[model samples]
Target: MQFIINQISSFLKPDLTILALGADTRQRVSWTQSQKIYSLSPKKDLSDIRGFYFQAARFLKRAFRLSPDTITFDPHPNFVCKKEVDSIRGSYFPKASLAPIFHHIAHAANFGIE
Candidate 1:
């Protein structure tokens, strides 16, 4: 959390923040009272916290005047609909180019992504 605060503090007055989200293997499960209890039991996988991560990303984006875009399984594993990506795109950068950039692969080029 401190890392996020530091990031927001360092951004220029006007800057872009791209936040992304994805579901982990653990999150690809059904939610139940037992699951909640298990989660609180400290025996649940921390990997299941995908939802919170996305939530935090959104929070930080707003705090730093940034934009958020998330990625998730196209045919989501645990849900009937797969719309987070399109929702984010529509809400944040509706007019921005919808180019498919291999972001992770371009971690050293211009802006750390060509």
Candidate 2:
């Protein structure tokens, strides 16, 4: 995951804090600073949009000291995860940049594929 993040960092803004929204089944949030990840949420099944939103808000407010300069989400148009992320971005971090990654590429990279 670190290697993949390193590779992808080239396409992202430098010196910016990032919040990464994990895939749907094992939903989680990662707070990234200086290329390292600090998990803000435990891996769990997020069953509904309201639950996800509530947890995300709690994590963002309680876990991290700084607001994210950017947020990342899986690039699947119909994905509920993406919709949730979009809601967060719109409601809380409207000025932050969004970096949507290709779902298959992220999956392959997680397995150490180039």
Candidate 3:
């Protein structure tokens, strides 16, 4: 997340306004409305993640109407492995701007004392 934030702060020019689609810049570390998410956990049976992703993609296609650039959060399969960075690139986001935000980085930073 810090990496993404840094990219936004550093890479994007000051004049260009950044419209974050799937994330809430206000909350920073938490979820917020208007940000759509599709979670595909093998454990859960109710919400089919892939199905939802397709739906979101369709919606985006219509909503964007062929915008120049788009950024999204698509986790890689190697997210569980030590190589949390590479998996998603091979599987999902070969094209288009994508960011991999590490949950553990945040968790470890916020770990509570027992």
* Candidates 2 and 3 compared by lDDT, better number: 2
On lDDT, the candidate that comes out on top is 2
Cα RMSD to the true fold for all candidates: 12.2, 6.0, 11.0
Pairs of colliding residues, candidate 2:
none
Model 3 lDDT vs. the true structure? Answer: 0.29
Supply every candidate's count of residue pairs whose N, Cα or C atoms clash at under 3 angstroms.
Answer: 0, 0, 1
- Candidate 3 lDDT for residue 8: 12
- Consecutive 10-residue window with the lowest summed lDDT within model 3: 1-10
Off by over 4 Å in 1: 1-46, 49-53, 68-83, 91-95, 107-114
Evaluate model 3: give its TM-score.
0.33
lDDT of each: 0.32, 0.61, 0.29
Which residue pairs come into collision in candidate 1?
Answer: none
The segments of candidate 2 whose C-alpha lies over 4 angstroms from its true place after superposition are 1-14, 108-114
